[model samples]
Target: MMVNDPNLFWFGCVLWLVIIWLIVSLRHSNKVDSPTESNTAGAREIEELRQECLRLREELQMQSKQLKTDFQNATFSQLQTLLNNYPSVRKMTEAKPDLPAKNLVSLFTSLDNLLASWGYEQIGSAWEQVPYNPQLHQPDTNDIAEGELVYIRFVGYREGSRILSPAKVSRTLPISSPSK
Candidate 1:
């Protein structure tokens, strides 16, 4: 019985050593795994931040493009308003007849230059006579013949295929001769 007791004591010591080794190994492994998990979480957060930044940049670019388009439209609207007012001034000058021809020419030339810069162009010339066509001219009165055209009252303007304004014109009728 004494010899069996010594054997049992050594067996118990070996078993305790194995249990302590296992516990230490498990703790070391847990420490290693915790750092890896934290690193993965950090990488995920960084990726999310990057995606957010890209989305913000795209939004900013879209906003800038919209602003540019709005500014261009506003500028075009102002130019159209200025062009619309020119015909009244031109008519007033014509009525006076005392205004110098050179002054009128200069004013028209400058206006033409401004229009050309903005992709707009005058469609007709003053005193131009052409065969009457309903598509290009608007008649002021219906008293004259249909086929004839006299001096234009106001010139037309166009941009691309769009007509900004139509020409105002009068038609001339041939005078009837007395019976032979």
Candidate 2:
């Protein structure tokens, strides 16, 4: 129209250049910031992984403690009868200030029950005079050789094929005599 308006044509060219420059600059800024964005994402992921590891460790510790408690319960629960009578034993002693030896039968019975519950067998009766087998008897003196007659002071205990405690043996029997 009217000689194409030379001033308007120059203005249009400048505006187009500005628009192109803005587009290129915006794309360059985004490209430059891309690595920083990725680094931030990587840091966040690492923190999340650390948190998960801590959670797993805590869970494992809890399970270990629980298993320990369960094992202890299982081990002690074998002597349920003895545990049940333990309180009564204390009360019996308290009730009788002058408690005689024979009145302590309850205590002995509890001990026997405890040993039986653990699958143990008594090696010898108290004051039992038997020919010594070194495997089953522990003599008071080293001079007392095997196959000699010895008396049991306190009965020993054994489990299946394994000896827990060998019978305590002496050369002479006690005055109380053997109580089979």
Candidate 3:
């Protein structure tokens, strides 16, 4: 009967692989030990091929790293204008004057969508009240205690399980009173 059992199937594969390995190893050793000029030439060719493979592998790795750095630089350059306007954004959150907040909001929504596509997510919404968790929130003052209720003064971001920034938490909201 054919060894159709899954365990036997795997064992059979291992057994065949070991046998093939042994045969190849014996042949390779015999070739290396041969005193013939042709054997020496073949051995030199194999060494050269192995060295080329290593050199190519290292070059590929360097190119990959450079590409990654170039991508990061490009992203930062594109986002520089948005980053420069952060002070205005922070002020808008605090004492919002009769400015074009609607346009700013639309821009922020688009930015949020962009960040979401890049696997970044907001840790907490601006002015959102939540129980204090030191791991996720950075207190504004030393007076703040763990497990206490706090309002997020500034929203933070993260990618997967890694926190990019902790939400800036304060005892009071910067704007009009937020109901508990």
Candidate 4:
């Protein structure tokens, strides 16, 4: 083999330097690219976290609404039960003097609140003494007055405009004098 020329040797050295420089620069570039890739992944994770939070909030709202609906239904059902038990309660009151009237009144007021919560209310005029109307009064005829309603025996109830029950009334009657 011929001995290498000086110019050729110098060119070879220069070529080797260029190749080394390219290799080192490529390694550094790869290092920088990895951090950028990791940052992009981190950003994607944050976006996913945000989406999950939104989904949870929506679920909470739906559950809250459902709870409110269930509560209202339960309250209405309680009111219906209280109203249906009224006849039996009145009979018990007649049999037992020890049963407190105040306690019974408080229970009725609680029932009124329950009704009001579900958009029903005790009839206001039911408390006031009024003339007997066949349309408004349903009497058992056991308790008789004379001509018109002497008193409202129990409170009437309604839901909006629809009457739940007519007022139980006693009619006024003329007292006959003993024959002289």
lDDT of 4 by residue, 92-124 (tens): 454554677525744575665666676765432
Tens digit per residue, CA lDDT, model 1, 26-132: 56665776877756655665566567656755765687678765774566566655564456445545555566642654566676676677677665654456666
Candidate 3: pairs in clash: none
Q: Write the per-residue lDDT of candidate 3 for residues 78-161, one digit (tens) a residue.
A: 774563345336456445555566356555666656666667667777677898989888898988889999987677666678
Scored by lDDT, the top model is: 3
By TM-score, the best candidate is 3
TM-score of each: 0.44, 0.44, 0.54, 0.39
Report lDDT (Cα) of residue 33, candidate 4. 68
Model 2: how far residue 104 lies from native, Å: 0.9
Better of 2 and 4 by TM-score: 2
lDDT of each: 0.60, 0.64, 0.66, 0.56
* Per-model tally of clashing residue pairs: 0, 0, 0, 7
lDDT ranking from best candidate downward: 3, 2, 1, 4
